[model samples]
Each structure stands twice: as C-alpha cells, then as structure tokens.
Target: MRTHKYRTTDVAVDGGTLHAGVWEPVETIEGAEVPTALLIHGITASHLAWPFVVAQLPDHRVIAPDLRGRGGSHAVAGRSSMRAHAADMQALLDACGAESAAVVGHSMGAFVAVVLADTAPDRVTRLVLVDGGLPFDVPAMPDLEPEEVVNAILGPTAERLSKRFADVEEYLAFWRAHPAFQESWSREVEQYFAYDLVPVGSSLRPATSLETTIEDMLDLNTGSTLTDALARVAGPHAVRDAGQPSVLFYTVPRGLQNEVPGLYPPGYVEGLLAQHPVLEHHRFEELNHYSVVMTERGAAVLGGPLREAITERPAAVG
Candidate 1:
C-alpha cells in the first residue's frame, strides 16, 4: 500500500537523453544518510518497470532509467553495447549527484550492472541482479548467423519490436494477452505498458529500437566486455579480489511464460556461484520473470533482499 512518489527526468548521456525515474520515500528514515540503488530494466522495457519495486522499498531512493533506444529515448542514436550502457550508468550517477549506489539490473540490465561494477568499481557499491546475469544458456552453434542467434533466444521479444499495433490501446491489449502479464494485471502494469508505445507513421509500435535490442542481445551472448566484467567480478586479475563482493542475484523458477524452466537454465546459476562464491542468490518458485517487479508479491520479496543489499554490511570475509 505504499504509494511511492517519484519524478521523471532526462539526463544527457553519450548518445542521447536517458529518461530516468527518481523515487523518493514518503517518510524519512532515522538517519539522514539515504542509501540509493539504481534499477535497470530488461530488453524492450523502460524506467516504468520498477514502479512496484519502488513502492515496496519506501526507505531507499530508487533511480530507474530507460536505457538508450527504449521508452522515452526510443530514438536515441548510439552504438548499443554492454560497456556503453555501463558508462552511461556512471554518467547518470554523476548527474544525479550520487557518489555511489547499489546497481541492480533485471534481465539484460543485470549484465550491464555486472559490467558497471567491474569497469567502474568506484561508482558501484553493490550489485543486485534480478532474473539475469551469469549468462543465459544459449547453445554454441557456429552455423547460426547473429540475427538467427538473436531470434532464437529472444523469441517473441525480437518479433514484437517490428510488429506495429493499430493504436496505443492495441499495444496494451497485446501486453494483456501476453502469458507473462495475463494473470498479473493492474493500473501500474497498464501504465508501464502505455509507456512502451510510440507513434510509427500512422500506427504505433514499441518504443524500443529493434536493431539496438538485437545488438544488445548479441552482446549479452558474446560481448567481450561482458565476459571480462564477469571475470573481474570473480577475482580474476585484481590483487585483493578475494573472490567475494557485496552482490545479490535473484532468479525466478519460471520463465516469462510462467511455464518454461527460467532465464537461467538449471545448474547454470549454481555452478557460476560456486566459482564466484560472492553472489548472494534467492530463488522464488512462484514468481515469473516479469512478475519479479510487476507484481506485489514479487516486489515484496525483492524489496526485502534489496534493502539488505543497500543498507546492511557485506558478509564478513570467510
């Protein structure tokens, strides 16, 4: 029942403006030292994706941004890469005057958070990756073209980018019919869906750029920056990199459809965590990928762990 109040603003970045959602708590915490966390949304998503999560974390300041070439910045022109996205995060923090913040990313955003934490460690205090990171279990097929690779993994998301809807309402209807959000509809959901629409000629289409999305998809799979970031986070080259850090990674048992296995295939997360031994993970059997922030229950679960990640001390060196 927390009605989080927030303001929408745009900040100058490398290519174009990044539309951001800045949420402030209704009540002040005991200490004036406010902890800030940056929430990054998934592919084909916008800053609006974190409204429910913001509502739950009333004590913390949440900064969610519409990654370039999505939502309000749909026309943002730039080469999309995980490294570029991570740098934008640093610039965003500077613009917002936050010296450091916990970086949390959902889905593709998780990969960006990992890159940010590794590439710009001074600006990132912690990392919370929701439903992403550690890499998706994409098969290694040398014969498949990059486009083919993207289409195979992205599924409906890749197709939806180009499919134009008759109107905003029609686009919202499409989302309503989606298996992920079909059972979890609300005003907030509708608002988020509404923000996804953009006028294309006479028709309407999703605000995200299909090409940018595909490029990012490719980066998530084979980008060198991403691989390097993961290595550094796991203590590869740093001297005091003792294979530990304040990282929280959460995953839902079900996929976007609430039927498939999940974004992180079985054994993928466990093996990666075993190697890194720093990422604190929480798995939810009932929550789907989209509902992790879209639904109340999902937000509640995320809010609790997210609060601890931001305010609590890192686990004692073991």
Candidate 2:
C-alpha cells in the first residue's frame, strides 16, 4: 500500500481563516496531474473524522476542512448556513489549487456538498453522499421552536456541545463508552476525540459552537437551499443531462445508536431513488451511521466505490 504525507493549512474564507487537513500521496509522477478528493465531515465532527477514509485513497489528494463553526474554525465570525459553508468549501478548493474535485460528504457535510455543486457546478467533478444530502422525513410540529427540533433530531450529540470536560481524557472516556464506538474503538478514534477539545478557562470544551450547530441544523432541515440544490443536480431535469457528474449515495441500516432504520430508512431511500434515478445507491448492512465513514471497516468497504468515482470518465455525449 502506498503511504501519504499529511499536513494542516489555513484557508482564507468569508468569516475568518478556515482550517483544513490535506493528505498527499508520497509518490507521484513527475508531470502527471493528481486528482483531488474533498471529504466533508458530519455535524459536530472535525477534519480528523476522515483519516480512515484518507488511508483508503492513495492516488488522490484528499482535503478535509473543519467547517466555519466547528473544530479549529469554531471562532469564525458569521451565521452558519448551508450556503455559507459551501462558499468556504469553494475557498478551500482555491487555496489548494484544485479546479475541481471528487466530493464526498457524510451527514451534514453531504448537504454542504450538494449546495457547493449547485452554486459552483464547475468546481465539482463527481459526488459521493455518504449517509446525508437527502432531506429527512421530519414530521411538522408547529408549536416546536428550532432548538427543540435540533434537540429532538440530534439528542445527546447536540447536548455534548454545551458540556465542559476537566481534560481530554475525560472527554475521551465519554466517547469510549458510546454505543457507536464500543465495537469499533481504536487509537485513531481517541485522537479524533482529543482534537475536539479547546481550552475554556479552567475547563476544556468541544470546539463546536452550540448556536452555530443549531443554526445549521435549522437551515438544513427547514431551508430551501439544499432542496433547490438537490433539484438542480439530481432532480428530473438535471438527470437528462449526460454531462452532469455521476452521483453515488451510500446508506447503512443503523443510526447513531446502532438502532434500526438509519438516517435514511430503506423504504424512504428507495422512494428517493425512484424520484431521482440519477443517483446510484449502495448499502452497507453491517455498519451504522457513524461507522460508515469513521471506522476502518467502513473505509475499506468504500475504497472500491470511491476509487471508481474518482477515476471514472464522463460518458460521451451524442
């Protein structure tokens, strides 16, 4: 297997400096162009969430960013929304000198990827939406506020944002006992969690901002940006264009807690495929939502499909 060199760089964006992680293949041809893959992490996750997947792609340059309001970019000044996030991604691409890339996103990151493709179509070559991008079938509750909705959807994941830990080990212990990582635990996972902590007075807190997360979730679940973007790229009209980049959607059977019927339920996803045949669906029955991109097993299963997307040639137009 080929090895890679990893580094972190600061990308200038609208609100402030965005932090990004880049992985380059150790060996490259003297004059050949190397393809780039941009991986977006889920809500409340850092760029570290992608190291496992990065290991599986040895030939392409992989770029993963901590979105404006998360991880090292948490202090970025602005209202967090899908469109804003997309703009940051565009800036990151420019900073990396990539004209276009094979984009892969997990959870909320998938939503950002869709908007980036629609708003800046030329910057995206292909898309792999892992466990995100499609709208959820959330029931209407006119009486509920946005925070209530976020709490309901994210549960403990969102609550953790407001927590303060005594140290990195304390935070690590919390995740070590989580149901999602109980069976998939590893040293890499520990490092990912430790990177999430930021100093706050006498305590350390997760770098993700609660207000930003709430704003983003509200936009993703209730705003029209994603809905319109999905239509333009994967809707009936867009499907007719052979020049559009190929899109692949992968889903797992379980969710954050290893519960059945994951983020995209089987029947619901089938209906989505029926409505938008342009999207190709792949299912991994053994993994859950978190593991689908964070675990070695999940990354191994995705290596083949991701490589195919990266190297695939566009179909010849008639």
Candidate 3:
C-alpha cells in the first residue's frame, strides 16, 4: 500500500471558510513540478470520500473539499448552487497555488465540475465525471414540491439527514445495514461515516444541512445552470478544439441500495453519449454508486483512467 501525507485547510471563499483535505505525494523529485488533481465529493458527503481514490493516486497532489453545505463546511453561509460550488472551487485552486488541474467529480460534484469548466475553461486541464454531470431523465411533474422531489430521487439517503443518532456508533450501525456498503465496508469507510457526525443536543446528526441538501438537489435536477454549462462544453465546437479539456464519464450498474439501473441507466447513458459524442464512457460492472469511488477495488479499477487524464494532453474528440 502506498502512503501519503494528509491534512486539512480552511480556504476563504465568497460566503465563508471552506474546509478542504490535501494529500501530498509520498515521494517527490527535488526540482520537478508535481501535477495536481481536484476531487469533488457528492451532495451529502465530505472530503473523506476520496481516501481510497487518493491511495490509488500516489504520484499526484490530491485536493478534495467539503462542498458548501456538506461535511466540515456545513456552516458555510450561502445557498448551495452549482455556480456557488464552482466559485468555491476557483478560490480553492487559487489558495493552493494550482493554476490548472485534472478535475474529477463524483455525483453532484460532477455537475459543479461542468460548471467550473464552463465558467473558467483555462483552469481545467480535463474532466473525469464519476456517475454524474449529465442530466437525468426524471419524470416531469409540475405538482411536486421541492422536498417531495428530493425524497423521490434520494429516498432514504435524504431521510437520514433529518434523523438523529444516539452516537457515532449508532450512525455507523445505520450505514452498516445499508445494502450498498455491506460487502465493501472497511476501517476507511467507518472513518468516513464517523466524521459525518456532529452533536445535536444529546444526540448526533449528520453534518450536512437538510435545507441545503434539498436546495442543491432540486437545483441540480431542475435548474438551468447545469443545462447551460453542459451545452457549452458538450457542443461541437468545444470538442473540436484541442485546447479544450476532454471529458471522461464512468457509470455504475447499481444504485445506492444495490438496485439495478443506477443513477444513469444503461439505455439512458447510451442515448446521452449518442447525443454528446464528446464524452467518453466507461462502466464498472459490479460497483454501485457509493462503492465506485469509496472502495479499494473500485479505486484500483479507476486509477489507470485517472492517471491517463492527469498526464495526457487534451485531444479533439469529435
């Protein structure tokens, strides 16, 4: 196993301090420049989500941040939107002195990555979107409230945000019972869940704010920011430019609960790729949404593609 140094830093952004996790390469040449890769986590997750992925990337400097409404930045005062998250990323890059980086995002972070690439194309060298970034084919319903929509999409994951646990172990117990993590559970996974707890009087609640999650969930699914951003990068002219970043998208076969037709179903993905043509698609057969970036096996499978994206030059796709 390759070991790396890890530390947390608070970066100043538009709203308030944003907490980020930085992992340095175990060995570095005296005068050579080390490449940087930015990893962004999901809606209700923290920077801890990248530990397994970071282990797979021993040759690069890895930085992962708790999005505005999640993890240690739960108290960051602002409405959680794709643009807001992208702005925070821009500030994080500046603070770390990383002029350009290979950007990788999972879940909602992928949406933010798309927005960042659109808003600041010069800062992104390439994009690797893990199980997100593209729009989902959700059924249109005009009568549904935002919370109802979130509940329908996220199911028990969103429900857990409202419930309180007796302690950290209690929270761990809850996650242990989840179908997604039963086979992939490890000490790293335990640490990831443990770090998610904060005291709520006598009990502990997940640090992610329910209101913020609902706002972000609804925005990403229904808002125009992602739609507009995707149009700019997925368009023909953008893909024809060798100077523009290339995009790689990975999808899983199962979802949060080990159910088939994961976030991006097979048919949906085929149609999406057919439409965009710019996105290169890869599928992980056995992994689900959570394990794709959080488990050792999943990280091992993803390491090669990530390394290629970080070191290879951008090429025209269409």
Model 3: per-residue lDDT, tens digit, 1-318? Answer: 566899999999877899999999989889998888899999899999999999887878999999997788888997889999999999999999999888999988999999998898888887889998998656775688888888887889999999999988889999999999989999999999999988889999999978998889878877588878888877554565545446899999998788988889988998988777688899989999999999999998888888877778843222
Show how many residue pairs clash in every candidate, following the order shown.
0, 0, 0
Question: lDDT of candidate 1 vs native?
Answer: 0.80
For model 2, residues 169-214, the per-residue Cα lDDT tens digits are: 8999899888899999988888899999899999999999789888
Regions of candidate 3 where Cα sits further than 4 Å from its true position = 242-245, 314-318
| Sequence-dependent TM-score of model 1 | 0.93
Error of model 1, residue 306, in angstroms: 1.8
Cα lDDT computed for each candidate against the true fold: 0.80, 0.87, 0.87
- For candidate 3, the lDDT comes to 0.87
| TM-score per candidate | 0.93, 0.96, 0.96
Poorest 10 consecutive residues by lDDT, candidate 3:
236-245
